[model samples]
Target: MRKEKVHINIVVIGHVDSGKSTTTGHLIYKLGGIDKRVIERFEKEAAEMNKRSFKYAWVLDKLKAERERGITIDIALWKFETTKYYCTVIDAPGHRDFIKNMITGTSQADCAVLIIDSTTGGFEAGISKDGQTREHALLAFTLGVKQMICCCNKRVIERFEKEAAEMNKRSFKYAWVLDKLKAERERGITIDIALWKFETTKYYCTVIDAPGHRDFIKNMITGTSQADCAVLIIDSTTGGFEAGISKDGQTREHALLAFTLGVKQMICCCNKMDATTPKYSKARYDEIVKEVSSYLKKVGYNPDKIPFVPISGFEGDNMIERSTNLDWYKGPTLLEALDLIQEPKRPTDKPLRLPLQDVYKIGGIGTVPVGRVETGVLKPGMVVTFGPTGLTTEVKSVEMHHEALQEALPGDNVGFNVKNVAVKDLKRGFVASNSKEDPAKEAASFTSQVIIMNHPGQIGNGYAPVLDCHTSHIAVKFAEILTKIDRRSGKELEKEPKFLKNGDAGFVKMIPTKPMVVETFSEYPPLGRFAVRDMRQTVAVGVIKSVEKKDPTGAKVTKAAAKKK
Candidate 1:
C-alpha cells in the first residue's frame, strides 16, 4: 500500500526587515521541493520572460528579489512538500495595513513560523520596539495555530503554551492594536490604498487604487486627495458582491466619497467573472450593472458616462486583452477604459499655493519650509508669500530629495530656503503663494457643502470640530447652516436647518477657531477639501464652496522679496 501525504497550512510572520520571506525561501529550498508540474509552470513563465535559466531556484530567487524591493506580490499561499507533509505557507507583510490579511492567513494555519532578526539592534528594533511583531504573535496565538517554531537567526526554538502565555501578557500594553484587531474581526477586510502606475497606449497614468472603506478618511482625505478617475472593483462571486455592496462595505463608501471629492471619471469593474456561477454569466453581469449603476447614480455620478467593464482580475479576462469567457459582453477592457478617461488638465497656470507641512531649520541653511505645491509653479528666486499673516519672502532655492530643481509644479513636494524668514515666523498650516498674484489669505469664514458620515450626536451652531485640509489641522465651528440640499442634485430641500445629523448633506458656513487658509474648490482643490474630525475619528467631510478672505495688513516683507518688485 502507498503512504498518503499529510497537508498543512503554515503562516510565516515577523517584523519589517526581519527576513521572513528569506527564511521561508530557505526552508522551501532545504526541507522539500515544489511539485514537478508547478516547477515546469514557473520554468515556462521564466522562458516567456526571456530568462535563460529554467531552474526552480532561479524563480524563487526572482520572487525574493521582488519582495526585497517592496513590491507586494499578492500571492496569499505558497505550496511546498516536506518529507512528512505537504505544506501551504502564508508569508505576511510586516505592516499595519496587511494585519487583516495576516489574521485571515493565520486563521487557516496549522502551524506558524516566527522569524526574528537576532543581529545587534535588529532584534530590539524589530520585536521589542515594533508593535506589529507583537500583534502578529498575539494573533497567531489567539487564532489557535497548533504549533509555532520561532526562528531566531539560525537557531529554532519550539515552545507551545508558555510562548502563547508570554505573547498574551506582553501585548496587553498595545491595547489600541488589540482593539483594532477585535474590530477587524467584526468588520472584515478593511484595506489601505495603493498608487498604481501603469502605461496605456494613450497616457502614462497614476491610479489611486483604494483597498477598502475603513481608514479611508485618513488615507484618501490625508493622502492622495486628488484623482482623475476612480475604478470601483466589484467582486462577481455569489456572496462576494453582496458583502462588498452591503452597508459599511467598501463599494458604496468608496463610490460616494470619490464622487463627493470630485473624481471626474468612474469605472465600475465587475471582477472575478471566472468564479461567477455558470462561469461568465451575462445575466449576472447585467444584474450587477443594473444594481451598481443605480447605486452610483445615487452617489452623484452620471452612470451614463461611466464604463461598466466585466473582468476577472485573476484570470486575465477583459483586463488587458479580450477574453472569450466574457465574449457575450463587449464594452471595453479595463486597460481600454483606463485609456478612455479624459486626461485631467494640469493646474500649473493658477497662482502658487503651497501649504506648509513643516518648517525645518538646518545647520548650514537658514530657514526651509517643505510642502507640496498645490497650484501654479514654484521656481528658485521667486517672491513667495506666506498666508494668514502675509509674511513675504523670496525663494532662495528649491530642492526635492536633496536634488536641486529648476521649478516645482503642482503636486511636487519640495523644500525651499526662504530669504529672510525665521523658523518662528513660519509654521504648519500656513500657505505659500506668489506674492504678486491673488495670494491666499486667512479665511474669516467659508461656506461648504458638508456630508456627515459618522457622528454620534447632532451638529448645530457652535459645534466646533478639527478640520484637516492640506497639511492643516484646525478646529472650525459651524457658524450657520445655510441650507440642506439633496446630495445628488444639489437642489435645496430645507432652508437653514437647525441641526445636521449623520448622512445629511447641507451647505454650512464655518468659522475657523484659529488662523487657517482655505480656497474655493473651483480654484485650488487641494486647499478646498476638508475632513471633520471629532473625538479622534473622522465624523464628516466637506468641500469649500466659497471663502470669505480676511485681508491681512501690516504683513512683514522680507528684504529679498521687497527687492523683487
Candidate 2:
C-alpha cells in the first residue's frame, strides 16, 4: 500500500545577500534533491563566466539575465522529497525591484523560513535602521505566517569573514566595505511566484522564497497573508541578535504583525553557532533567547512555547541532522520542527463560492473561467450564476491541475468551461455559484467595519478609495461614517466622526462606484474581506457587515391624472 503524504506550504524570506537563495539551494542539494546533471551544467556555466562561486545559486536563478546579473529576478520552483514528506520550494527574488514577485510567492505559503546572514556586519546591515530584513519579517508575520524557522546563512558569513580578514591585512576602511557590498547589490528583480515541492520523513512541504525589499511590502503582505506559521533566523555571532531586535530593526515589528494576523506559532533559529566559539555561542544563545522572549511577550506571544534552535545552513548542522557543536541545546532539528507543525483546518463544508481569477477562451474549450474554490463544491453540468453581471451559465466541464474532474471542492484551483457565457460577458473578480441555490447578486451598497492602515490625511464622507475584494478591484466611496470604534476593544467611541485618520477603526457605509459582488462577513468571509487602497498604497482593510440593494428609480403616476385618463 502506498503511504499517504501530508502537505505543507513554506516560503523562504530575508534581506538580499542574506543567502535566502543560496541556503535554499544548498539545503535541497544537501538532501540529494538536485539532479546531478543539472548541477554539472550550472557548474560548467559558472566556470565559463568566471563566476564559479555562484554555482549553487544557479539552481534557482535559471534566467540568463538573472545568472548574468547574479541575482534572482523571479520566483523559481523546485521539488524534492524527504523520508516521509513531499515539499515544494518557492525561491523568490530578494531585490527591492522584484518585491511584487516576492509578495506573489509568499501569499500561498503555509509556513516561512527567514534566512539571516551571520557575518560580522551582515546581520547588522540587513536588520539595520530601514533595512529590508525587518520589513520582510514584519510582512510575513502580518500576512499570517504563524510558524517560522530562522536560518542564519553561515556560508555567506564565512565568505564575508574571509574578505574582511584580507581587507584588514591591507588596512581597509569602511568605504572599502561599502564598495564590496555595492558590487553584490546591483541586480534585477522579479514579480511572480514560483511553485515547487519536496518531502520530509513525515510530511510534504511547499516552500516560497519571498522578496524582502521595502518597495515590495504590498506583495509581501499578499504573500504572508496565506501562511500559518513562521521561522525567524538569527546570527549566532556578537551583535547579531541585538541589532536584529533593536528599535530600528524589523524583528519586533514582524513578530507583532504576525501575531496580529493570527499566526500563533513561531520557531526561532540561532544560525552559525558552528562558526562561533563554544563559549561565545552559548552566551549569544542565552542573550538572544532572553532578549527575543522579552520582546515577544510585549507583543502578546507566549515566548515559552517558541522553540529556539541552533544550526548552520552551510555546515548542515542541526538542519537535517542534529548538531554536536551545541551540546547544551536540545530541540527538534529544522526539518523535524517543520514536520511537527500542525496543519490548519480548512473550511470546506460551506456553500459553493468560487471567486473568478481569470477568463480565457481556448481554441476548443470555448469560454472558460479559472479560480480557486473558496468554499463548498463545484461540479460539471451545474447551472452556475456569476454576479455582478448576473450571467447564468452551465458548467460544461471542470479541469484542475491539467486533469479533468467530475467535481471540485474548496481549496482546489480549477478551470471550468461554461456553456452560453461569452468571453466578453465575463471578467475577473466575479463570484460563481449554484444558480438555483443562493445565486450571487450585485451589491448596491454595504456597511463595513474598517481599520485604516495608512492615509496621508483625514478621510470624511464621500472619500473614494479602491476596494480590493477577492479578485475584484473597484473604486468605492465612503457614503457615511456611522460610528468610530476602538481597534482593540471594538467599543463604540463616537458617532459620525468628522474624519478618520491613520490607525483608526470605524463603522462606515460604503458604495461602490461600479457594480460589485460582496457578501456580509458573517455569512461569507472569503468575499466579505477587502482592502482599501488610495494613492497607490493600501489605506485600510474592511469587512462587509450588511448590504443594501440598489432599488430602481422611476417616475410615479399621480392618482388624479390616472383617473382623468
Candidate 3:
C-alpha cells in the first residue's frame, strides 16, 4: 500500500448548463467518495426550494440566492479519493461577474480541465466572442500549466455540434489568436464547452473546459487557471460539419488558442456515436476522421498526436468503460485518459509566498488568514509580514480542514492563526513571506507603467484610476505620461501620445491620494505591484518603476521648517 496519498487539486469549469455540475456529480458518484445521505438531503432541500433538477451542485452551492439562480456564484470545494490519488475539485461559477471568484479557485489548483461542447463546439460568438480566447490562453501560459487535453461534450445536439466543428474549421486565418477578430465579431456568443487538461511530468495536473458563452466565460478562465490537462468533446454525427463557419472565412483560430495554452496531449471523445442508424459503418467513421484530421493539420497539429474515442455520458457508453457500438473506433475510454494522466509536482524550491486572498476572524479562533500558498514552506510560529503595509504577525497555529498541523507546505489549503493584527487591516492581495523585510510605503511621487482603458472621454496627461495594491487601494493620478511602449514586445513606440490605447504600455509619474505602502519594482516585486481600475473594469496593471529620492512637489510643509522658510 502507498503510505502517502497523491493529492491533486482539480477545478471543473465550462459554460453554464454545459454539464459541469453533472459531470462532477457523476465523478463523485463513481468514486464513491461523497456520502449518499448528504446527496439525499440536498435532493430534498432542492425539492423544497423548487429546484427539481438540482443534484450535486445543490450540495455545494450553499448560498440561498445561488440555489434560486441555479448557477454557482462562488467557488465550492470538495474532496474524493481514487485508488491512485486523492483529488479535490474547486467548482467555480460560469458567469462573467463572478470572475474574481473563479480567479480565487484557479489559483489553488494543480491542474485544470478545459471542457468543450462537442455539440456546439468553439464559436465566434457569445461572451467568449471578444478577446476572451486569447486572454484565457495567455493567462494559462502565464500561470505555467505544463500539459493539457481537450474534452468536447454535447454531441447529442447535432445542430449545435455542427456549428462547433465549423467554428474550429474556420479559426485558421490569423497569425495569432487575437488578430482573427475585430470588435464586432468578438461580441458574438459561444455556446459549447471546450474541455482540456494540463500538467507537468511529475509535479501536478489540471483540467479546464472553456465554455461557449459570454455569461459563462468567467468559468472557463477560472478552470483554465487551475488545469494541468484538458479534454475536447466531439459530436460524431456532426464531425466536419459547417454551421458556425462563414462562407467567406477560412482558418481555425479557436483550436489554435487551446493548443497554445500548452495543451500537448488530447482526448477527442466522439460522443453519441450510437445515436444514428447505419451505425458502426466504416465509411462514416473514416469520413469523420478525415475531416477532423484535415482541420487538425490546418491548426498545426498531427492527428496521431491525439487519441479520439467514442462515448455517451448519459447512456454509459465509453465514459468509464469501453463502448460496444463503436467497435471500429479503437481508443482509450474517457476514464482511461483521466487515469493515465500524471500528477504535477509542487514547486518547493521557490521562496514561500502566499497572497492574502481573504482574512476573517473565526468565532473561536483569532485572526485567520485564508490563502493558497504559492511557494515555499509555511510553518507555525513563523514570523511573516503583510504587504507594503509592513504589518507583521506571528503564526499561532495552522489548520487544514479540522486537523491542526505545525506547518504547511505548498499546495496545502490551510488556515493559520496570526497574532497582533486587526482583521480589517489585513486586506486582500497582501503577500506573506518568511523573511523579515519591511513592506514598501507609498511614496508621494512614484513612477509606473500604465495602460489606458475604458473611460467616457479621452485620457490625457493626468489620467487617474483607483490603484489597488497589496492590502491597500487608493486613488492615483498620472502626473505625466513619459513614453509609450508595446505591451507584448516591450519596444518603445513613436513620440509621446496624449492618450494611451487599450493595451499600450507606458511609463508615467503617479500621485496617490494618500500615503500608502508601495516599493520600487527593483527591490520588492510584491510591494511594487499595482492594478488600476475604474468603476467598471481593470484599466491597467503596473509595477512601481521608481521612487523619487526627494519629493518633487513641496506641497507638504513641516511646522518646524516654516520658521526657517
Alpha carbon lDDT of each predicted model: 0.49, 0.54, 0.43
Q: Which digits, one per residue and each the tens of the lDDT, describe model 2 over residues 319-403?
A: 7777676566677777776676666444567777887645889997799897556667899877777777666667878985356
Q: Which regions of candidate 2 fall more than 4 Å away from where they truly are?
A: 1-3, 28-33, 46-107, 118-145, 158-190, 228-316, 324-328, 353-373, 378-446, 452-479, 510-521, 524-544, 547-565
* TM-score of candidate 1 to 2 decimals: 0.57
Model 1 per-residue lDDT tens digits across residues 103-166: 3333333443433333223333333312222333333333333233333321111233654632
Q: Give the winner by TM-score: 2 or 3.
A: 2
Candidate 2 at 431: error in angstroms? 5.5
Which model scores highest in TM-score?
2
Q: How many clashing residue pairs, candidate 3?
A: 92
State TM-scores per candidate: 0.57, 0.70, 0.62
Candidate 2 lDDT trough over 10 residues, lowest sum:
170-179
Model 3: lDDT of residue 85 = 53
Error of 3 at 82 (Å): 5.4
Off by over 4 Å in 3: 1-6, 47-50, 81-86, 121-128, 131-135, 155-347, 420-422, 435-482, 486-489, 502-565
Per-candidate clashes come to 0, 54, 92
What is the descending lDDT order? 2, 1, 3
